[model samples]
Target: MTNVSQLARPHLRSLLMHVPDGILDAPTSVGTAVVATIGVGLALRGARRELDDRTAPLAGLVALFVFASQMLKFPVAAGTSGHLLGGALAAVLIGPWTATLALAVVLLVQSLAFADGGVTALGTNVTLLGIVGVWVGWLVFVGVRALLPKRPASVVPAAAAGALVSVPAAALVFTALFAIGGQVPVPLDRLAAAMVGVHTLIGVGEAVITALAVSSIVAVRPDLVHGARRTLAQRPLTIREKVPA
Candidate 1:
């Protein structure tokens, strides 16, 4: 197990390096920056609400967990070992805004402190994994929830499907970014296809982890989950038994 883990790390880093430069455009960068800032603010505010009771500690734990998980890259096919893109799971377990903050912290730490990725490429990682991941995952979860029957059972599947799709969606975004400014010579079509294909398989792993995390939170503390809030009963109104006497 240790040998396998050790072998996979280099392959994962290589795949990340093959990614093209300047994929994160200025406009996209500004937008993600705004979203990420807002998310961090919201998380801090929410924590004050004794949402701290649930989401605060959980978010902290998840941020660290995600940061660590990304470090343990695993083999995908030949020279690529897939790493965790925790956007879907984080957003589903936390909220989109907060998930952004969580992932941002993870990415920042990975780049600055740990040097997992180059400092210059920080923007690319943030754009692909932080912004795209959260948006795609949150959108998928919301869409699936609307289509599926509202039940405890649906929660897992919704989270799972959302998680599964988000990885590929992010990969495509990265591919596009690469096409814009890739260093290594590779055709756009070939790059996009390879990225999307492998990441699709990788999504399964992401989805399973996300689903379990979501399911666990929903089962124990439904209020902490943004997606689950809809499934809950609204507060009843009782104004003097329907009207004033």
Candidate 2:
């Protein structure tokens, strides 16, 4: 059999260069519309929650923030500069479902109004930002809470870690899609590794931005944070479990 090390090398690099730059088509536009509709429903449902009353405005703010953030893309080593995939940060701030809706609105406005991302590629962007970003951010928050102390002090770390992981996760998803439908003829393994590696660095930026945003909110109103609520609920258990141990 081919050596495992040899096998993985090419695929890693593939992730970095792989972009669906040329695949924009009719289906992509329709896809965005569908996500926007679903996203609207999810947003409305979350907004009905009492907590969401506060979180809803944050959602709008998130849309605005994402719009502005994308405009100031920083130079990555790749020819492609990267921007914040704020879905995870948003989800961690509010909730995952609400985040999905918020990012969808951001994307819709970007495509139809601002002409930022390709109107034909709205599907790709939504899948990357709306779906992938939410899950990555949420999972990282859950993980940080599980690994760290249960005190409210852990909020920044958990959010920072969540935000850090969120970016590369989105990058990996894009890498996968690019593998299937990439314009460039690059090896998938190399592409994945390159994408993951660089994005891992970019994720640091994502982490910093997300952590700052979460900390600002937490500082003003800890009760407004859904992640904080979970942390609080799990607090009493830490002492109980510690006593048993």
For candidate 1, lDDT tens digit of each residue in 1-245?
01111212323323542122233455554554565555557656653543456577878887887887777676666655676688888877767767777887888886778666545566566766777887799899889987887765576788888889988887787676555645445566766666678788778878877777778878878877767766665435446656766
Clashing pairs in 1: 20-182, 23-177
Q: Point out where model 2 deviates above 4 Å.
A: 1-21, 24-51, 78-80, 233-245
- Name the regions of candidate 1 deviating beyond 4 angstroms: 1-14, 17-53, 234-245
Instruction: Give TM per candidate.
Output: 0.76, 0.76
In terms of TM-score, how similar is model 2 to the real structure?
0.76
lDDT of each: 0.67, 0.67
Q: What is the lDDT of residue 43 in candidate 1?
A: 57
